[model samples]
Target: MFSDILCVILFCTLHFIASSSELQPGMPNVCADQEMSMLGARQPCVQAFTRMVKVWKQGCNSHRWCMGYERRTAYYTVYRQVYNMDTHTVYKCCPGWRQDGKEMGCLHRVCSANTCFNGGQCAETGDKICQCPLGFKGTQCQYDVNECERDEGGCEGFCCNTIGSFYCKCPEGSRLGPDGRVCHDVNECEELNGGCQQTCVDTPGSHHCECNEGFRMHSDGRTCIAVNSCSVLNGGCEHKCVDTGNNNYKCECRKNYQLKRDGRHCEYTRVHCSCRPGFTLAADGKNCEGIEMEIVNSCEKINGGCSHHCEHTTNGPLCSCNHGYQLALDRKTYSDECVSGGACCRHFCRNYPGGYECSCRAGHRLNPDGCGCDDVDECLAETSGCEHDCVNTLGTYECFCELGFRLDQDQHSCIYLLFRKVPQLLQYTAALHSRYVSDEDDSDGGDREVEIQRGRRGELRLSSSIVCLDGSFGDDCSVSCEDCDHGVCSENRDQCECAAGWTGIICNKTCSQGTYGPACNSLCRCQNGGSCDPVTGKCVCPPGVQGLLCEDGCPRGHFGMHCRRKCNCPNNGHCHRLYGGCLCSPGLYGRLCHLCEYQ
Candidate 1:
């Protein structure tokens, strides 16, 4: 029985040991320390503490914890309760081990508690913070992303936000593009041409109506109407325009007019003119008149007989004299009676039945008016007539010979100037006489030869005579002088003698202050402090004077004599009778100042 009791005691002791080995309440399956002794199996405890520190460093909850022993104590207690086991005396866990609700293993380094939503991520930070994705907001990312709030999702037209996404929309006439953000215009005209009658133009959001060629749009802007070409200024016709249907027209000209090349204008076919005698038909053979015809034998007409010679005039005929003749007292008979005593002929005269004929010597001809004679240009007419040179005079021409020759009396021939050296002999004789006189005191032998030469020179010089022509006077017949003012020059002398009231050698000087005219014989008749023009003999009066002489004041209504004048103009007008002009006041005009301009 004692042996049986010993066996039972031993079995009871083994059962107690086995029960102690089993995990108890508040105790982990693996223990780092035994009896809470650091020296016994302290490695497992150190390892477990190190793992807890690591988990705390990572984060105890989705919300970050404060970094302090006091703040971490609560987290440490919770972590210890969640991960370690209680042995009725101490709490412990295995080395490098942790517990996270139904899972026991190594420490989890992340602080994620399913707090973030909609693709958001919870960050392992000191505080509970959610890193939301794009377009998301709020603490736990519970709100949908509002992409439209920021930038309208980069939409071109309109934006619409919905549950973490966005969409773009367009207007009525536009549609969204492939990019889902841009808008494109919808061309309604492209389909059935917008149901237009003629043409339709597509606009940005709508369309418009138009017309085709030669057609205009109606007021409704949809229907097309036929254009009326004739409605525009009668088709731009000069005469009558007739429409020929279908926007076409034709121009019709009036009487005596025809259409021009442009088919729209009209031009007169007949030209009219004033019919008059002596006018011929025009080149166009129309009603116009042309140049006048020439009249002939006008003296044969009635009341057109001329006493001497009949000459045709523009109006009719007239009497005239023949060449080299003059009309008599009857004004019809030509005769030479004027040349007998009237001094009509300049050179020669001849008598005729009805007129007097005047003739000029050779190298002269009658003037155009048949009053005087003029020298003929013989050199120009007959260039070969002279041997060397030709000189013309009043009634004759002279031919000049060369230096060794002379002109003959016939005036057209040249002769040698024989004995030309005779004048040179006189010069030699004087030189010889001077030398003889100078040497006389030294020797008198050369005196006799010099005296003989001097006597011969004097004889030859005396025999030769230098005769001056009729209008010329001088030792060599070379000097000439014109008659004095209004006075004739004497043929024998070259002196100038002025006429009455005239002076100066060349007869060019006029009379003194009180005389004027050809011979300056007229006396001045100026009055009222007036002066005379020396050449014109007209009076120059002072201010306030008029007439031939300045002897009167300005006329009534006339002012400064320089410009202002009197006026008898009507309708409050002014007139300048001196200039035959009239100036009417405002609203009135005309030569007589009787017309109203505005009216």
Candidate 2:
């Protein structure tokens, strides 16, 4: 019996130990911190379920008991469930945003065409202007326009701009590229060899640098450094070594020196040389020449060694100097004239090698001697193209017209006035002395037509009486009147009684396109931006444009310039283009015409 009892005890102890080992939750099954995104786009993914341990009566611990009766404490395992929240804390980027490299936060994506400044606005979208006016973008308006993409913002070189303002930028040592969608060549060589130390070779698409003949490329590539020195190889030459092509060399002698028979060495060869009669050898013991020689038209050879021009003549090497220069003592070189006070031009003088030239300023002419400038008389020279009279001033000229005529758009010709009517008494002149015409108000209060002041320079004003019904003076109005050249002939043949918008020999022609007045002398005086009748000079104003020249906008209740067009708009609705219907702003729906768009 004792042995059996001991066996039972041992079995119970082993079973109990095994049960405890099985219940050991080592790492809680590795419940990793997990998360899920919420419905809100801007909301961050956050802890979904609580990260606390699950301990709701996970069954009482059978392995051990506290005081045999205390409510058995439950065993539990810890885990984490994440829910999306608090956008600032999220590790992932939201829609429309991306992680640029290892940047701490997501960066706004943009195109790489040009510099992207700070601006994005919905064109006509109401209210909901922008979440962040300067930086952030929310979807209220869709269409966008950046200046860089349009005409390159008028910059002949590369250009960039945001909706607000712009700042031009280029990498150092670079030039602004042409504007628009044009493919052009940027002369890299133009900007100081494009940052190259030596020769800069440019191609249609690229450029590069090259070293000189006896130079080797440096580590920096663009710069060039000389070779170790010809002493390295001696070149097997006695005097100097010259490199021609790859692996090729040649020997040369110094001035007044000659090479030996072996071609490897050089020796002095200076000695007296035989020359023609009247000639002597130079100090170098080489060349021989004479002080004077005779030759005809000898300019072809080396341009006669003249600094500027060589005159071909029977004489030998007839050398001459250019305009602003003078022949030097040697006659082969030239010297500046203005440096020694050769300038005598009245206005300004420019000097060169052999001579100097004088010129006049604008509105002035050079005198006959070519050394002085004088004010030109425009009237005497048929200049200014004046139809009536030319008045000469200090350095300019003015054009004036007769009393009945006005200056034409050409500023030189004179034409009849607009809407002229004959009065009971007339005061006028054939010729006046002043230089310019002054405009003064006429008798009518609303009239823009002007009348000139009385004669001041002892000019006469002829007062005429109405003898004949027509402007003609000879017997039966047979001859056409000079004053009625392009005006209508009234029943009595009165020139001033002619109707408006007539032209031609007898004022019978109608004014041509967009022109006004019988002689088409006056352009329409319509203020604002109104279009005028070519013949009658009547103004036609556009909708919402008011005043004589369409100067102001239409009022709320009406549309046309005269407030003729009326509309029925309610709930703070506004008129459409022609005011034919109503248009609402943001909130109101349809007041008659639902023309407003949401975004």
All models: lDDT? Answer: 0.55, 0.52
Model 2 per-residue lDDT tens digits across residues 220-284 = 34544445333334544557977543223456898888876544457798566666434677887
lDDT comparing candidate 1 with the true structure: 0.55
Report the Cα lDDT for residue 162, model 2. 57
Q: Which candidate wins on TM-score?
A: 1
| After superposition, candidate 2 runs with Cα above 4 Å error | 1-377, 384-487, 496-499, 503-525, 529-531, 540-549, 553-599
Q: What is the C-alpha lDDT profile of model 1 across 50-116, one tens digit per residue?
A: 3223223336467566343332222122212124434435434443234554333323333356757
Give the candidate number with the greatest lDDT. Answer: 1
Estimate candidate 1's RMSD in Å.
Answer: 53.3
User: In angstroms, how far off is 546's CA in candidate 1?
Assistant: 99
How do all models score by TM-score?
A: 0.19, 0.18
